[model samples]
Target: MTQASESHNGLPTEIPSCALLQLLANSLVLSQTAPYLSCYDVLNLAATARPFRFLVYHTPNVFRRLELGNVKTAQFDIDAIDRGGETWRNVQLDENLTEDDFYSGPLRGIFSNLRRMDILRDVQVLSLDGLSVTAELVHDILVDPAYSVRILSIRGVKNLNERKLRGALQYACRSSRPRGTPRLKGLYVFGPRDTVPALAAAHEGSGSSSPTSPATVATAWNNRSQKALSDALAEEPEAWYVRRGSQFPHRISSEWASTLVACSGIVSFDSVLCTGPRHFNSPAWGTVNTEALDAAASSTAPSVPHFSVATHSLGGCASCGAAPEGWTVWGEEVVASRRESDGRRTSESCMTDLARFPLLAPPPMHSASLRVAMCPAGQTVRSRLPFIPTVKQQKARFIPRCFDCIRDRYCGGCHRWWCESCYIGPRASSPGGYAASSTGPDSVSSPFPNTSAASDDNAGLVSKIRDGVCADGKCSLGQR
Candidate 1:
């Protein structure tokens, strides 16, 4: 009777914080398999009664990523303290959002919070194809010393201009970043190869140094902080690496390796054409930048990409173009682009062949110089070289025709080939079907088919493949 009276009175507080926490724990366990009880659904339970609400309010740490939708309204903008995250955050506004709603309202509020914490941040990965982020706002982020944004993806952002984009990038590393610890490491600016440079130029938060002495502009791009990336996992499986081309392993060749080697950490290396593959939204370059030659090669590939007269080598109309350390400007650039339109015949071209890329490719005109973007999170200053070395004229003169290009004319070992080289593997046989060395794993199969040097001891087996005979089943020399 006394217990019933106490229950009816419902004194000051009915339950303790421990009881609330216990409820949360129970809900989490129930949510494991029940499709109806989502993690968010568990949070909603807090609104059910006072005990449940106490648990949700006290333990906020359980939420790492906070997202809301049409029905919900919320956000998170705190200092990056200890946790590797960006402080100047940006999220979509609470109302009706269109394509142009990127830089204002909700995003601005988020960035303001980031500024409070002084950490440069980035969206995990996003394309800039139709975004309306203006160059001015991006410039503001670049110029700030505390700026720490890396890898800005403006895939299809067309509103950006070249000069402004350049300014934004130069602003990133223009001076030292906040150093006691790293908030933001490197920046990556990606998009459909050609369309992105302009945006990168304008929205380039991967700042540059001061424009004082002429020589200051002469800096080489190389990636830093490799130890951190290496220790990330003993050896990053091929899955961890991504090239500009295909899905899985990010297919890339030697031509794109220099840029890859320059980026410090384990990065998803994007492939862009130095002198070709200009179309960004075409069906051909749908998911990646895969060229024909890369698709054919199998087994272990060349450590680096080989160039060709028709492919890699590029000579610029360099009043606006970039080659290595020593290259001269040949002419000015003119960039005119024609997007996919209403039944209009499309036109595009390569970076070198005047016929393909006449007038700085596509030809309307953007800021052009004889330098490539310096750091993945950086940009290059404009400078002229005392001399210009052409790619086609390089010593190797490597060409890529096919995976099985073992023809004598294209074989580097054939002595007659200069333009291109045939494919060979360390595995078993070379083009002439000879082992690179008899001691390696790929050495000719034992019993020595046609191996005259040892014929005196093993005459019968040695004659099997030596005289273009396949006496024994599965002999490569005989197949050759």
Candidate 2:
């Protein structure tokens, strides 16, 4: 649309709207608006005008985040490519490939599509999650001066070798670039088999009172890696990797542990793996002996051995007295030997929820001496107890669970379990010390010295909790 106005010579002068749009496009207004626009929205807007198209292609903010690995987008591309007689699987070609070779590969169309959309240049956050991208492609992207990419996510990139990925990251970190140019400050590499043993060990040793935080775990693991970033954590603390799987898999290799530790800068990594009740249904819960599980559940003495050497130094469970932090309630004792004549007791128990816990060394079918029932919660009103009773309380007696079973909403002082709702409710009961508030306002004073406001302060509360106390302010357990 054009607007006409009278000129000094009485001739009509035409005014162009594109000139106004162009000015605004190059201004701070466009920068502000670009972040809120999706990749599609920006492309659509650019298509509407030549000036917009040029500005959108050149502007860094317009494509700061390029999510090439989005599930829906990937699916759409796959369908579209299939219709065009193209394959979707990655190319398994000879090593030391080039960009020209990539153009003829399975990922050829994707790169072409990226070029068509002008995506890669100046992209700060690029997510190539679940793509079978080669290490060369990833390294090229990281090293490219055109890209301002600060974070690169390569989760589920199966073909990416650890050594090649390491070299690429090391090169990018040490590469001499212009001032104010961003280096790879954040990297996420989550493959199916990747696991960290240091974190698992730390988690096993950590307890209700002295929990191993993610930051602490990262720092400890980073120390082991021996490669420190100049200002990695200070700039981007959230730089990390996440496995969409179990906290502790049954079989973990030493190589995988070393790889996790060896990951260097911009790779400033942390792991937040999945945990909780639903994890029981996973394939990790395969072996179980019904009769042994039943027997162990009803056994008078349910003693479990400590597996980790580190956990031994941390002492045992407060309730069970001898069971260590990561103690196993399934599988035979470490001392037992197995024979083929002793067939696995393939019972209905293996298919049940009770078989959720990770198996110890011995095959569950071979021994009935080690299996124990899973902890189940009970109703609060009927129980009328400070500590929440297990479901077994309705039929039989209460059984003390391993630290892993009763993780959250549990008292570290006495290892007593509490319902999730009650722990976070308005009472705001502290996990430390004997929770007098849960019993009622008329409850007796805490076992520690003073019950005054000053004594209930942060320092006093910590001391009282550390010293140890349970429901009735009478737990006789000593400090760790």
Candidate 3:
């Protein structure tokens, strides 16, 4: 078995040709030949040689992303990381570290909305829960000409007293310098139950759209908002201590007119809490009155209060998902009252799907002549229920959501929640006025890059591409 002993016993003294290369080749063969290798095998393979160990250690593209657990942290340095990408969740800690080992952690605060943009963009979703992010820091990030970011989703910072919060939204996303647009213009803010009202009055009118206000988009969008809407639209899950207002991106004046309007057959729907469709099943559906819901179902009525609101909050048949308990139906009136007895009839009707309008406001549910269905979306009912995703996110590091990303293989792109026939397919068939991609052919790349020319052009293209830039140089093409 020993080479020296075999040579001594009468064999060629010369060693086998290229033993070092052959051993290296054998190791490579074993790596490829093994149908499957366990994590231990991988570690063993890394131990094979110094070069192999470093190859395994520094390889970034091995995973589409690196995920860290709540109790775990990656000792990763992202400098010049052209090979790998990583994402962190529950990255926030309730306790501030004692020693100076602080990058201050990830962002955990609610942010105000910013206008969409067109440019090479960098987005960072920051959370600011129970902590303070000073205005000076924001000024440095936003005001500094070099620190331009496309999207900034600030979540959870409900702890900032009123003054700091105001400064963040007003100036952080905008710049005072002339001829200079704000790098942080597209902003999203959430948390602290009072922020909405404060910002709403400042941006839009106190209750309705003003010709001068940009936030005066529509009241219908906010009329049937769930309490989670503010938190959900933000960068994080339902942030506790969040300030709730029904209408977001709404003109200030429209706030007065928005309310949760209930349709027939359903009694109560919780707008603040998305307690999954409890049927808003009203006793009126079976015994006293069924016409209100029937009208909404039929889509008929010229006399009902035109400026009304509705929702799936309790009227449509389960056979047709058109009316969920929180969906807003219109053209009918539901008399809403607070005294528990004042009864005025409110008609309910749904519009054709082509336009996709939202509920404005049902009548007001109040003590005197409280319209039976005028409760606002922000108004809470007596029944308390835990939100579905909130309970789920608590246990998981991050929910794998394919809703927004289109490149996902199985869930690539949200075809279900959004209109499929509309912008769902190819951008070519998309309606002229609508599209998320502002850049035309000049900036876009062909999805089918398997062509011969593409292969030649991509000389150093990665094998299992975790993420990449396309011909147009877009950093987010096919990003998971």
Candidate 4:
């Protein structure tokens, strides 16, 4: 046989390098393998050659899921670990990076690193779980005009306050305007119940003049007994209180109630409360009662066909109930219920106890139970009926007539009905030519005819009634 041109190791040595590259590029291994690489593995591959860099950084849909901070192994990236380590420390200390610069500073390197990758623009689902998430980080992400993030999950994040939460929500709910629509659709936030107070504080400090601010409704409680309200606040600071004059009597906190009402484009918001050992044991366990408050308010607000809020506490360990010395039943009924049972316990039995003693039990330790669904194009505040009580007949009689004048008209002041003349002052075209007098406290009431000292107390009472009505002949009850 003619001496065969020896092929190197039975390979085609004569094949051109360009053809070999084309063959490799066309092979399923190269074309389809990038999607299978772990984020860290992809980073390593990108560092090896230009082709991989192009594949990972420039390829569309290659990085649809971008997770930062601590997540399950499936989402964790080694490159993120390195980025958060000493490399990030050096970047923070760099003199060239200004504090105001959006790209530099403590707690900002992760975002900067993400920005550099360019692949994040395509990220559809972003999870910032188990990270030291700053308000600035959240603000930057949601406020970015070009951001394409759709679903965001924030669990075990630190320093996340209500201002940041509200800012993010507002940004997510912001209309795209000329751009057509927003990309963010859903947000999930879960954490210890202790954070609830921080959220309240943030809302209080925001100084927003919107109708939903707690300050606007603070006056609605002016007529209530201060001592009683103070006692309730002392017992449970996060407890919800119904406005003394609201149409629906269900109680809820002004701040959170406004938050729920102000929310637009929200399809559903659900919160669950679970009693944990931390509530009893932790020093910071005061404001863990938002679930009950939210649930109560949900019933009073305008009913949305899609909106719903539900809250329930989880039962403590039944085995713990058996432990004689260290164990403490949540309430008297819990202790009795445990004793009444047939001495058999299952998860179902514990859950049954949870339902049976919902409000009787103390607040929960963990409150990782806030879930919100948003529409892609954003939403408008649902049109709500004015929060005025509807007419009701009972025992062949109507109640809530004006204490002064017995007429059946909506009472915006005390949430009762009053005749139009008594509640809204004398009509403009009165037959007696009596102009509508000012209802201010200083105004002398002509209704009380007695001038003697014995009638002085009665005069004071009449004066208080006049002060209760609006000076403009309109109901002075603040916005719900």
Candidate 5:
């Protein structure tokens, strides 16, 4: 066996030649074995020996998918909260290091080390789900010239707003050299809704026609918040900002759609959801701003191909367009009833003429309280100073029903319309009892138990007259 094949510790001391090892590694490709090796698996193989390490490090084609954080099948050692921040700085900078070696390190370190190792340069699919990503990190990875990243998924990352997202995309598209090269093809960003306005502001600032100033952007955001608040107040006086539930994790705002339209080279955008305070009749997702997208597509150079934007929620309820079955807007009332012997006002005695309705109530002479009425238009109309309204303008106020539950009680606290089932309590016996009843022409059953009463009033307007029973079996709207 000679010195070359000499045995040491009951093992041959001679190692396989680099060429032979390379050939063996090459043979481990998809045609012979599995199509791909995980980032972890590749790193493990690399740790075996110097020859194997060299083969794994140089052979970038072997790794097509790189999942960083905890996925369905795999759980990374990196902390979800710390996001490998503390661990990354201490990681040893050795030549044999792979991304899996930095599993305990930050995403930034992994990306940087990948660039240093030249491993992920050919990586096709990169999933950063269940990870904490910064704007700068996102920009660096997406715009890195060394990376030919085709599919990028950043779902479940907190605080990643539309502006940062759009910036990364724009940077990626711009960084693609000589044009016509495949930039990022697929992007999945299911981030929080609060990040949307910043993206919208950025897009507005970069507008070709009229650029919005920072002050304008601030004003616009404030206005949007104020509008939301006003709408909430109209539903109920004690309303505040409350998150609405949806099938998807992230809330898709109008600004999000605009951001998607503005960005280029994104083939498929997934996991978009509609922002709530969503009506029962609201579509799972809002319509994509196709007009803006079309306009964007038209403005872009013909060389840039338009990719399809996808969302989980898109269509809305058909009943959403129609007004509630019975709604009226009437003025305030001034009740004057004498106590009865039975301690209950008789039906005949309680009945009052419609003309006697307080079109203009007598203002309290001494009281300092200012009564502010929320108009149907979601604006506050003060009644301190009395003003005569024309007969034509004296219309009955219509209260819209909860689109989902068809219940009349709208929660001002959450700014969401809820039926007795949602706002009050859970149903006792049957789930079907809580569901919204279909009002099809041929359907025999009516949502309201007193259908005859509803029909008697002017065009179903009397439906509002019926008392609303809450989940607790108490009449929330009071007895008729």
Candidate 6:
């Protein structure tokens, strides 16, 4: 029923009980504001009232990208808070505590709200990174005929692999997508393979425990948290656990040719080259770096060159332009005569060959060293070395052909890599003497000084270095 109120002018005004919601849900107002709100913000707003819940849930724009990474953290916080710090610490310290012993505990409130909302209706991009999502939830999202998600990121999702993704991929390939709309491009399964060195150093400096010490406890937490909310809805099938095989299950090996045959919908496989965090700018994951992938996803393109950022090792020779297999750098005396007895290349042999090449990989800001010259392309280079110490000290993160870059020269002083042109060009001979020596000048006379590793701006630091200006605005090369 409408109620009448007296205005300041003594006029009778009709005000409805739902007047507030009516004004807020006006098309003009919603259109102006809805785009800016995040998934959490929308969910939080919806919880305020019943009408708001219906409005937020019905809006397709609100669910374009679903980032539920924080949900996992929320679950952890509730569990830790519910159990006192002493109890939680005891659980962490328990040596005999198996992963099976841990459970998600009571965290069905926010998660229950999440499941009730129809956030998946028009979702184009879905990120479940680090979430303990159930196989049922994953299957329903992927295999369902109603929901259509273009790009699904499942990095760090426990117990998920090719076996679980098979039905989704099959459905994506066979299903018909509307014109101009995105088709299921790829399912990302890559994440940070190892902890950042800076983080490890920070922990050590802070007198924190070893990173590996909490791994068992973390595993147990992840297992118990898997579908803690979904379990309330329905029990998962036993086959879901059986198919995973091991506690640490292997995803579809992108290295295998059979993987492509199995998952036909996936335009590109980047599980091997994912060396950094998945959310931010990583050249390894084409969706974050390249628009060419989006175009490829819509059209029928058998091969996507832009998708292969880590295709070649160091490219061809700078002079004759010979291929990597036959071409060898001039001063590469390390593996000059190295030969494979079986005439077949393995990962081990590839890493051996990579040792001879002068290369540099971009480091994530969190892990960047003050000693090294930074590259704008920010991501950790994944390198596993048991043999070569020279390259190890350089903090080379990736193996040969792991990342795509063409640098013919490496400087140990500035800890930077350069191409022949950049090494010999006028810019190299500029004020900073950036190219003065392959091994930069002595610290006392060197123009290119190391910047602080604490600086968050990589682009600014790299720009300043390339311009050949010292931090003090003086030219070390004795020229302006």
Q: Give TM per candidate.
A: 0.27, 0.36, 0.21, 0.34, 0.37, 0.35
lDDT (C-alpha, whole model) for all candidates: 0.30, 0.39, 0.27, 0.35, 0.39, 0.36
List model 6 lDDT by residue over 1-480, tens digit each. Answer: 555555574322422347756665554555446544656777788798656776666544556555555554434442322332345523552545433233222122333455566455556556566655444455555556445655556666543444546545554444374443224444545332222121112232345554465775575456545545445445321111111111112332334333334443333333222112121222233222222112212122233222222322232222224221233222222322444788855332222222122212211112112112121122223333342445424222222232222221222123233322112222332244332344433211222133232332211223222332223233334111
Q: Tell me how candidate 5 scores on lDDT.
A: 0.39
Clash totals for all models, in order? 52, 2, 68, 0, 11, 4
Residue 308 CA error for candidate 5 (Å)? 14
For candidate 5, the TM-score is: 0.37
The lDDT-based order of candidates, best leading, equals 5, 2, 6, 4, 1, 3
Error of 5 at 105 (Å): 8.0
Q: What is candidate 1's lDDT per residue for 1-480, written digit by digit as tens?
A: 222122233321334335644444453533322222333564567578665554444333232112211112222233222333333335323344432333433444445653563322322111222444456645654454444433233433444554555444544434364443222232333323232111112213457654455444332111223333445445322210111112122222333323323322322222222322212311122222223223222334442223211222222211122211122122223334576768665555323212211111111111111122221111113212232446633211111122222221121211121111111122223333333345653334322232244322221212222122232334332110
Q: What does candidate 3's lDDT look like per residue over 148-217, in tens digits?
A: 4423323333222334434534543333543554444322333221232212232233564443544443
Model 4 collision count: 0
| Superposed model 6: Cα runs more than 4 Å off | 1-38, 49-55, 72-115, 134-137, 162-183, 193-256, 264-480
- Per-residue CA lDDT of model 4 for 376-415, tens digit only, reads 0121112122222246411110111111111122234544
Instruction: Name the better of 3 and 5 by lDDT.
Output: 5
By TM-score rank, best first, the candidates go 5, 2, 6, 4, 1, 3
Best by TM-score: 5
Off by over 4 Å in 5: 1-38, 50-60, 70-105, 159-161, 170-178, 191-247, 264-267, 271-480
Question: Tens-digit lDDT track for model 2 on 1-480?
Answer: 655554574322321345656454554666667655556677788798555665667555666666555434443222221233333355443444454344324444555576665675556666566665677776766666656666566665545566766666555555374554335555555323222133223334446443368887685566545423433333321111111112232332223322323332223422211121212322223222212222212123233222110100112333233221232222212233334557754322122122222212111111112121112123221222334336644322122233333333234554443322112111223333233345554442332232233332212122222222343465444332
In candidate 2, which residue pairs get closer than 3 Å at backbone N, Cα or C atoms, i.e. clash? 185-266, 292-368
- Model 1 error, position 24 (Å): 4.4
The parts of candidate 3 lying over 4 Å away from their true place are 1-131, 172-177, 191-480
